[model samples]
Target: MNTLLKSQLWRGLLLAICLPGVAMAASIQALNYSSREVDYIAVENPGNTNSGGGGDSIRPYGQGGSICCFTVPEKWHADLKVVVVYQLSPDPTFHRETVSVPQYPDGKAGDIWLIVYEDGSVGAVVSLYGPSRPEWPGKIKGYPVPTKEYRDERRKQKLKREKASLLTVERGLLLRGNSLPDEKVKEIQEIIEFQKKVIQSLEGNP
Candidate 1:
């Protein structure tokens, strides 16, 4: 090997031996905007594996699990499929929400936002986030999604809902033709656009 290659090889070997978990390490945080403090959590390790157990980089939780820097390294620009689980504030019941987010520009190293309730329960919102605010949305209440398995199920159900919605709107538009009011047509148009986006997103995975 050339000098640079040899040097890199040694560095990898050293990290593997001396600091095994550094490569697998991921950080979890609970955001408390009102209090103005970020709370960090220690997470369990289950050795990092590449997505799909193959060349694909996105790891599916299958049922459920933790993701960190070991799996998605810092500076990674791709979006991730993740579930945020928490209890609805004051309800004492658990909820799960699925989201896709890449690492954020302002994010700290290894930081994964843990959904928290305003009253201090864990993840509660079941909303998909856009790229702009990669961090978890705080304190939104929704129905309970108990496990990663349930979260995955919910995700599938959502896609189905979108597909059905798109078909309905298209059929309605065709039937009504030019007779529909502008306001009514505009509302359906927005829903059609949103459903198309959701369906297109689902096509990328399973």
Candidate 2:
């Protein structure tokens, strides 16, 4: 190893050894790697009054804002784990899981991340660096990347939103009756036609 690398290793070891009783506080954040949308992710940090974390909803391949005040030991323990409660959208129910924290290569402290993987498996990780950085220690590398299923699900959501908007517009036009100008009426008709075609195309998609 080079001079800087060796220095960092020694520093990490020293902190873990010298600060055995020290506790490091880190904020909790959610990273979604699954195709489904995730929301209401609550982490139960035992003995901490601010244990309720993860209210932000994270889209597929996205990260939610961090919640404050969870503490971790200066030194890693074999049984370190967190209790995560979350809900996947359209499911109408919440899930509770106990996720074990992955080992950090350097015994340094950082923020806690609750990850929802592609296969629906969940895990927790601590990193001084973000997943995009090389220093991040985890089985998975890099931030969440969109999958084919995720793209399809997004398209379906867009179609639903558009259809709802179209219904509102149609209702408005009906209420206005012939009071709408001829040119304005024609423009609205053209837009409705275009939207219909778009909706049809999306609905037909597998």
Top candidate when judged by lDDT against the true structure = 2
| lDDT of model number 2 | 0.79
Q: Which 10-residue window in model 1 sums to the lowest lDDT?
A: 54-63
Predicted candidate 2 versus true structure: per-residue lDDT over 1-206, tens digit per residue? 89999999978855664465677667887888887888667677644536556567898788888887566766678888877778888786887788778777587778888888888777778878888898877668888888877778789899999899889878877888589998988888888888899899998886
| Cα-based TM-score, every candidate | 0.28, 0.67
In angstroms, what RMSD does candidate 1 have relative to the true structure?
17.5
Span of 10 residues, lowest total lDDT, candidate 2: 45-54
C-alpha lDDT of residue 53 in model 1: 15
Q: Write down the lDDT of every candidate, Cα atoms only.
A: 0.45, 0.79
**Cα deviation of 165, candidate 2, in Å:** 6.0
- The pairs that clash in candidate 1 are 86-122, 86-123, 115-123
User: Residue-wise lDDT of candidate 1 within 49-115, one digit each (tens)?
Assistant: 2221111111121111233332333343354445544433234544444555544444433445444
Model 2: lDDT of residue 154: 85
lDDT value for model 1: 0.45
